[model samples]
Target: MGKWSNQINGRGNWSFTKYIYDNLYNFQWINRENNEIEDNLILTKSISLERVEQYIYFKDIFKGEYFSKLLEIPEALEELKIHMPEGYKTKEDIIDVINSRALNPNLKALDMSLPTHLNFVLISLNLPPHEGEVNDPMEYIVDALEKKYTKEENN
Candidate 1:
């Protein structure tokens, strides 16, 4: 098997991690083969904020239902109350808040099956809040990928 297939197989079933890995790996290979100095590969697909919100809401709802035996609906609601942003009472409001804060402006569409757009979505979701500064996790990931792929350029 080729290197990409081997990496994908090794990553197993974590969708987000696998997505990031695939993009970074492929970009690195391209840069190496072409001897090009590129910071990031342009994302072809774009995801709407509405879609992102829907995914988050669905994921949360599914988890609530799937783990109902261990996690009560009331408890889940309480957690949502604490973590969810102010003025975000309904599911739609919460999704709006998440989209406004988490979704990268450069993102175009959702391609969950591939790394193109999903990597940016995952980056936004996975980024931790900074103490005083706004954190754009997608940029951080791009920087990391660039560094990883262009180490020779640095030296």
Candidate 2:
């Protein structure tokens, strides 16, 4: 129904795109739930990709407790490369994928583990925009997640 849906229609079976879309909604739900909880009662809070990486590094170094066994950074990156559209080499291609997925309503849902997925993709890939670069996939992802969450909240 939207630009993302059109793009998805143009290409059949965009599993990775669907994965990102679903995860973004899931992450948003988790954030909402975290916000609803009492501050002192919260045990673990949502974190950024950088923090995830740091935790992974520290866990590997100290062999301490494993926080989450979901998709790891390396695996997430490999999956991104595998699912990326053919001949997509530029950063815009990546941004398009993120935007398209964000706009895709069919795949939106509350999976709750989305931040893990997002962190995996973000830490594994280079999403920052360079000089003269017009699109930033990172920002698109955040906006998409927020928009989807807002829509869900209203409903």
Scored by lDDT, the top model is 1
lDDT tens digits, residue span 1-155, model 1: 12332123332321221255333222221234433333322322242122111122222322323434433466655666576666766555544554452443223223232244435454565533333332343444445557655875887
- Note the residue pairs that clash in candidate 2: none
lDDT of 2 at 48: 24
RMSD of 1: 17.8
TM-score to true structure, per model? 0.21, 0.20
Model 2 scores worst on lDDT over the 10 consecutive residues at 50-59
Global lDDT of each model? 0.39, 0.35
Indicate the TM-score of model 2. 0.20
lDDT of 1 at 134: 21
Index of the highest-TM-score prediction: 1
